[model samples]
Every structure is written in C-alpha cells, then in structure tokens.
Target: MSLRLAPSSKPSTAGSASVFDTSNSYGLHDTMRFGMRQIASEVTAKHPLENRLAEWENTQDELKMNLARNMYGMHAPIKMAMERSLVIKARGPSMLPRSSNLGLDILVGKDETIDFEDFLNVPELSTDMVDVHTVMEHQLGIRV
Candidate 1:
C-alpha cells in the first residue's frame, strides 16, 4: 500500500509579483529605469567608443574589412561561382508571360515594337538603372 501527497491549500499567486506592481516591487519599469541610468553613467564616464558605441565601431570595422577583401579580389571566386549557379538555376524551363498584342500596341505605338534591346537603349531607362547600380555599389562596396 502507498500514500499519495495532498496538494497545497495556499492561494495561487505565482506570476502576479512581476507583472502588475506600480509600487516598483518586481515590475519591468524599475528594471528598465535602472538599466537606462547605468547606461547613461557609463556613457558619461568613458570615451565615445565605450560599451554600445563599441558595437557600432566593430560593425564599421567589419564593413571596412569586407570592402578591402572585395577590392583585393579575395571573394571573387566565390562570388563568380554563386553568379554562375544563379544563372544556371534561372535558365531552367519556366512560364513566360503571355504576349498580348493589344497591350503591346498600347505600351508602344502600333507602328513601333518594344524589345529588350529597345528598352536598354532608352536613355531614361539606362539612367535609372545606372543610378540604382551606383547606390548599390556605394552601399555594398562592390561594383555591379
């Protein structure tokens, strides 16, 4: 024969202490206030590159390193392989957009035809593409 233990008859207030106390007993408001004060003190006591600012500095350093690597052709082989893989993957059979003569006539005059070559030859189109390429290159440190 075995005996079973009885459950406690005390009131259930397990998670109530941390959630709804405006008196600052165990709520998040006090914790956030303390953390903000600590961060402010540290910022005031140290150089600009201390603590959280160090993280930003480290990120900038990493971006500079990646830029140097790309400039020196260290990532060229991997980049080329990835480009080739993407090209091969995209060349697989896929549905092409249906050609609607009415839509084409509306877009380009009935006497004129719009093709990829004609699109590329458009000055405004080329300028927009160049602007996008320039911005991306500036951000990524790699020419498109």
Candidate 2:
C-alpha cells in the first residue's frame, strides 16, 4: 500500500486528493491513509525475536523426539545416554524460565516438566492459540 499527498486547487477527475484544506475546513484523509499503510508495514516486518523463537521451537521439538526415542530403548545405549544427558541439561533449573509460556503458567516443577498429554487435554489451551485459518490468512496476507 502506498499513500501520496498532493496539493490541488480542486478535485481531479481521475480521483480525489487524499487530504485537502479548503477555506477553514481541514481534511485528514491523507494522514489516515498513510497511518494505515504504516501500520500494515510495521506488522509485516517480522522482528528478530520471531525468527529466533521459530528456530528455538524447531530445535526443542527435535530434541524432545530424540529423548523420547532414547528413553524407549529404540536407540543404542551410548546414544540414549547422550540424549538423556542433553535432556537433563536442557531441563536444568536455570533453564526453567526459558521453558515458561507467556500468559500461561504450564510448567509443573523445577525440572520444567510438562505432560504433553495433560496439556493437550486442556480445552482452553487447545482453543487459545492462533487457529489454522488465522495462520493461513496471515501467511497469505489475505485480510477480511
């Protein structure tokens, strides 16, 4: 979206100038138009934190799956031990804050343990986050 402001003595046949001041009447059409465009631009510019957050989430999922497979003895003992150590270190006391969910206190212990089954069982949790339709629209830039 683009906003342009041009002074004119009278409205053009093509389209009306966004803002105009005639006599004592002060128009703010251009200001509002530009403001909306600026807002959209700001929203679309993803923050550094968002990129980092997506990376961290991907890493966490990979680690969780590796740990789960190791715990079930699907992997070799040496590999299982390494995965267990990594899981323990990742869940250490100092890492508790990093595991916490903003506006949602779901962790249960100093170990930062959270039962995935129990968490998924919560009706509120299932409905609270962004829905698939909302995510699709946001990704596709389709505004209703």
Query: Judged by lDDT against the true structure, how good is candidate 2?
Result: 0.43
Candidate 2 wrongly placed segments (more than 4 Å): 1-43, 70-144
Best by TM-score: 2
lDDT of each: 0.42, 0.43
Q: Residues 1-144, candidate 2, lDDT per residue (tens digit)? A: 112122232323232222332112354345543332233432454565554554554455455555556567556544645655665455432222344342232221224555673456555445345466776677689998
TM-score, cand. 1 vs. native? 0.17
Q: Model 1, 21-136: lDDT tens per residue?
A: 42366434465533222334324344433434435434443454455466766675456445545644453211222232333344223436566744566554343344555665
Clashes of each: 0, 0
Candidate 1, after superposition: displacement of residue 77 in Å? 15
- Which residue pairs show backbone clashes in model 2? none
